[model samples]
Target: MQKLVSEMDNMVLRGEIPQAVAKFFSNSAHTKDVDGSETATKEEAIQKLTGFVGAIAKVNEISLLNSSVGQDVSMSEFRFHFQMEDGSEINWHEVIRRKWKDGQVIDETYFQN
Candidate 1:
């Protein structure tokens, strides 16, 4: 579990958005809003996140804020720092829940804050 998290950290630090999306994500991603509407699909999720993160030139750091592991679900919070083109910095926070199937992530829910 630590190894997987480390890999994710590395992916983000390297600004390898595609590899990060593929390695840590599943084909089915979903988010339910406060009104209970859901947006699903890993592709869409990746597109949205990549568009947001890709605007930056480089990622400076990824920090694990917290984690909780259940029988088949793992929940984590990560803090991401990025370096922009003009030498500005931005920080983003994400909460992710991964549902494992056969030892791999089969479904995921990611929230950006």
Candidate 2:
């Protein structure tokens, strides 16, 4: 379960949406990008993330900082660094909380710094 979050982050950062949808999320998965955002369905989640990938110039790294697992849930903190089209860089420090069911994530939320 703990590794799932890391795998999903890599997939998103690398624009591997098909694999991410197939391996990381369940059919009814719900994902919230940040606070106050509506939880999205599997397809919506994929589209949202794919859009993000297209908007970025390059992904420098997705560094996992910490992780913990407890009873069907996994939490991970990661720093995502990427460059914009204009050559500006941004680093996002965020925590992902995921609920797993039958080896797939059914719910996920990202809290950012």
Candidate 3:
């Protein structure tokens, strides 16, 4: 989980969306659910993330407020902020749920507030 967040932060800093999305999901179902749709597979998740990233300008920061881990799932509360071309800031509260498989995230769900 820490590694995923760190990699995401690095991609944001570099303005690399594709790389960020690649690290965003473990499968398509995870990505589909994140988009407020039905479950998807890894490929579907990748396609969805691709579209989402294309719409956003640049991410300024991702702040994690807290995290809790269960037997197979981990939940994290975070604030995601982005910078627009006009120097405006947009903030969103997010809850990230990750499913662990062999100590790595094999699936993820992102909830926006």
Task: Estimate the TM-score of every prediction.
Answer: 0.60, 0.79, 0.61
Clashing pairs in 1: none
Write one digit per residue (lDDT tens) for candidate 2, span 22-68: 67888789887775665467777777766776777987887777878
How would the candidate models be sorted by lDDT, starting from the highest?
2, 1, 3
Candidates ranked by TM-score: 2, 3, 1
Q: What is the alpha-carbon lDDT for the whole of candidate 3?
A: 0.64
Top-lDDT structure, candidate number: 2
Q: Which ranges in model 2 have alpha carbons more than 4 Å from their true place? A: 2-18, 86-88
Candidate 1 wrongly placed segments (more than 4 Å): 1-6, 31-39, 83-89, 111-113
lDDT of each: 0.68, 0.77, 0.64
lDDT of 2 at 92: 92
Q: What is the overall TM-score of model 2 with all chains considered together?
A: 0.79
The candidate 3 region of ten consecutive residues with least summed lDDT is 25-34
